[model samples]
Target: MPLKSPITVVATSLLAAQALAVSVHNWWDVPSDFGNIAELQSSIRVPQGSDPIKTYWMANGFGNGYMGMQHNSDTERRILFSIWDDGQGSKVEPIRHGDNVTVGTFGGEGEGAQSYLVYDWKAGDTVYFRVQANVNEAEDYAEYTGYWGTDGQTWNLIASFRAEKQPYWLLEPYGFLENYGSDQSEIREGYYGNFVMINSNGQHHTPENFQFTHTDIFNEYREVWDQRLVEQGKEVYMRIDGPADQGAYPPAHH
Candidate 1:
């Protein structure tokens, strides 16, 4: 059968007026027929405005948590990855930790386990991320592992989580840029591309295309901020600027 075009979704909600910036999102809805996705890899770089706190370059995002680098604080940076729990209150089970990873449980957005490593990551430095999972849909479970590094360097193992009921594969990929800080006045941007997936049958693929979208929380203060997600073949640019009194994540800014 021929592959079908992927779908894009724009999530909307209310946010504090003019205080926090809206989260921008992008998706490459690559469906899988070959088999369950065994692994996925991609890269990202921030050529400008990477110094602000709560600026998350979510290079790998999905239905639940995300994986990428963040400006968590003025003095701290991290390679963060997390996956949600099974709704029945089954938290993510810890499987492994690389070298200096911190593993803990998280809530608020969703219940799940999270892992991170503090590194002095800088702007304009391209970082690569790869996620592989041992999935068993028949058993309705999976164990996911995330790794990160630069070219020609050993892949740094972030951590792994054994999901009891959260069976997942990297078939549908979502990446986004978010300015979670109170100051939405700053401009933030990123370049995301080279999305490749390896299937359970050892097939490798590059998604046919991608789409850009934002939230649906409508407000008159929408004009105070703007977000653009432009796709250039295999790569896409995610940018956000703001200070809107109240707004939403826009759509079709490709």
Candidate 2:
């Protein structure tokens, strides 16, 4: 049987401190058609002195997308996160990519040409974000990162992910959910539970299924992080409760 949800409380102390004062922008609001024309030319904004350290973009070919980071000498260190939607069923998969490496193959189609970049970044650094399409032909969309509650309907935008030289960046309504450990196995008997089951229709979750709680004080950590982002002028994206557009990304890029 599935284990019960861990009894935990989320805190907002730490989050309040690290928050930035920035507004999320819509991806369609930015310009497009700036591939390889400039370094960081999307709707997003990064402070000076720091270059783009990492980039996530769609594979021009056909397998999975790519993630890339820049070195001191402006060289790139890239890796493939996974093949075929980056192991996620989402419209866009965050895959890793770099030079001459055949990361993997897509479920269907010929091959994927992944690409990305990374630059110099440091703690206390803040940058603007906007989500855009993988390619010019793909649909216009935005990228967002935030949190999800038990309801999973309301969502806020903690950060935006955008493409370089593009006019707009995707605006994700939810913040990033960092899940640690494997959900397949239970760490401790009553201390924690296994499995996190989400309803196919909504974000509704069950604790017994390991679908509602975290092992390491998730609530407190999340609250702290959320507060920090808010203090930084960043807002925590939350969904009130409803079905999100799961078909945002097109199949061509996947």
Candidate 3:
């Protein structure tokens, strides 16, 4: 069975301290003509036994189209990067079709990508993620690669896929921390940090290089590690907390 959803939250005592706050944001909106984003990278740490029944993708994007991670159950996780094609979602599949990674079909045949086993994720360990997109004009296809690592330097190729007629750069670069599960009287929180984006030209951009258009916070109910909690728009720090109504928006404070 897939792992529980990759979510976050805080305990009652922790909440009382006000030391824990949930925050999420849709940062800088990258233009589709940004000459094609070559690669994007980020890191996150989930505390031990801090599981909530929701999905959380530390970083995600969508413009003409997009790709990202979805936390299914504790055992089932996926690195999804897709483009609109053939009236169906053409996603990246796994390098291997076994445990840890496998082919997933949802909407129809060839609709899902590599599903991962995230429930076994080591507690307090920082996992690094990288996604690369390249255009293959000869075939008019866009190739994408998902890489992961633990040391923060060495990355293992997780999966690679191609989408037809998706040659344009994807827009909307943002970090997401969510508790899609409806867990009132509690908040799901995760630590997202060390974000970097590499354009097709190989130029690096960080929070220090851009302004973030903050979205997805509903006051005390939903918040981010912003000036109210930490340095604003630092990018190195972010959080998502709430009891989402149908796994989309956050609910009011309990």
Candidate 4:
């Protein structure tokens, strides 16, 4: 069984608090020329001061679902994987799941199945995430598998879900950071890099340039950290919350 994670995750928690917090999101897209992709792998490192409670640092997100790590309640940090319904009337079903992991249905943020492992993923440590699609044309569904680990090569199988109207590839891969806690001025940052995409035809692409996006919150709050572009758009830097408008070096810079 490949259910064990290469990096051991000890359970830990943060004192959860609530009030008012801004949700900041960013995206990275692969070159359109590469075309339909079957798998997308990336890493995220929420630096020392960047990781906060009630934060979700999404690494690999597609048209249907997303897989990443989250800072849940005071006693639980998780490696989470969630997927919404097929939208054409078929709900996503869990075909397989890892050990000591929770798998079930989730509502509110679109109805779907969700899974997570209570692993104490520390801030400043890099965690890698990957999502691969296995399409069954005859069945008219695809089994999408989620994996996470410290090293890019070894991965722990988070869960596998069957999504209806599932395509042959993971369409529109992206990454975003979200803070769900109530802290209006706390700095939340995530460095998303080391992007590797494999197309349906078995072509590999190492994408470096990532474009930035600002949500509607930026229009309302107008926080300086919400302003993303750092140096000539070579790196995609996203900071949500705080008054200072400063930039940092890209962790994925090679």
- Candidate 3 stretches with Cα past 4 Å from truth are 1-23, 29-34, 47-50, 60-99, 107-114, 209-233, 240-254
Rank by TM-score, highest first. Answer: 4, 1, 3, 2
lDDT of each residue in 1-254, candidate 3, tens digit only = 22111111111211322333233445553554455567777766655444454555555443322334555565665554433332334343334422365444443212334334343455367777777777666655666666677777997665566656455443345555545455534344445556677787887765343333333345655432231122454433333443444222232322
What are the per-residue Cα lDDT tens digits for candidate 4 across 112-204?
789999999998898999999886767667788999999888999999998775544576667777666556465678777678889878899
Give the alpha carbon lDDT tens digit for every residue of 97-122 in model 2: 23333322343321222222233333
lDDT measured at residue 159 in model 1 versus the true structure, 0 to 100: 91
Write one digit per residue (lDDT tens) for candidate 1, span 8-42. Answer: 11121112212355666677656646567677788
| Model 2, C-alpha of 15: deviation from truth (Å) | 23
CA RMSD of all predictions: 5.8, 19.5, 10.6, 9.0
Q: What's each prediction's TM-score?
A: 0.81, 0.24, 0.63, 0.81
Global CA lDDT computed for model 1: 0.68
Looking at candidate 2, what is the lDDT of residue 159?
22
TM-score of 2: 0.24
Span of 10 residues, lowest total lDDT, candidate 2:
186-195
Q: Between the candidate structures 1 and 4, which one is better when assessed by lDDT?
A: 4
> Model 2, stretches more than 4 Å misplaced?
1-114, 134-172, 177-254
